[model samples]
Target: MVKYLDTPGGFVTKAAASLTLDAGCEFGGGVDCGSQYFLGFMAYHRAWFLQDRLALTVGGGAITNPGRYLVLLPPINGTTAASGTPYFTANPGDRYRAWDFQVAADVIPRPFITFRVEFNHRAANVPYFSGPGGVTPPGGNQGAPGSLVDGWSPDLVKTENRLTGALMVKL
Candidate 1:
């Protein structure tokens, strides 16, 4: 679930939480039999615009998940095992945690159109980002259901840096 609340003093608050059943496929699909997966976070960022032309925003947050798959984070994909098996163990204690910081800039060149650029950095105890080769399937059906599989894991990094640019139009 997610919620957004507007408060006094020009401040807004955001929060969210989610749960995944049959986590890691440990013991079938029952709630008692299967492992439980959880993810939760809350963050707030206030936008400051200078004369309605330039805008800046800053925010930070933390995340915890098992093997990066159970979290419903925006613009992030989890790591999967090549053998069609659960990559992470069912133990809830095996979860990994991460913290993120972000800064964004917006240039409101016109009334209806705006340009944005954002920079983000995340640090985790375990590896995260993809390496140079990327995570693509190999050239053969390695016993996967109607698909090919590569018997290799991605080279994950502990720290990740991302830069994004977008053009938004008000309709």
Candidate 2:
């Protein structure tokens, strides 16, 4: 289920959740059954002042995936969804969780243009975010896609903080 609310100078909220169930047999005819769940929620308030020319917003959200089947695996070593890497295996039933807080200010000089600056801080229970060294290998991608090279591993961290600016236009 999912829900969303949007109103300038008012409270906004959103929530989404999903579940997956799998029941089948493995290649060796062994029983394989499992269930995964994911839930997330976020809420924010947009306050408009100065004749509605400026606005401020603050919001936060959290997510939990008990069996991280829904989590996106980092593309280390030029890996892709179809070709997974061995450095960080995301098998079913693995735990992955994250939360984040954000604050943003927007300037709406005209009805069609908006400038925004936002700051965000996110954290995870496991090493999920990319680190300063990045996810690429030392000498770029080598060997087959998603395949490992000797003595090399991508950098991953548990926390991240960033500031971003964007210009939005609504035609």
Identify the leading candidate in terms of lDDT: 2
For residue 137, what is the lDDT in candidate 1?
Answer: 37
Clashing pairs in 2: none
lDDT of 2: 0.72
lDDT of 2 by residue, 44-92 (tens): 5556555556777787778777656567888888888788888767665
Q: Which ten residues in a row have the lowest lDDT in candidate 2?
A: 22-31
Can you list the residue pairs that collide in candidate 1?
none
lDDT of 1 at 150: 41
Return the lDDT, model 2, position 144: 82
Candidate 1, residue 123: the lDDT equals 84
Best by TM-score: 2
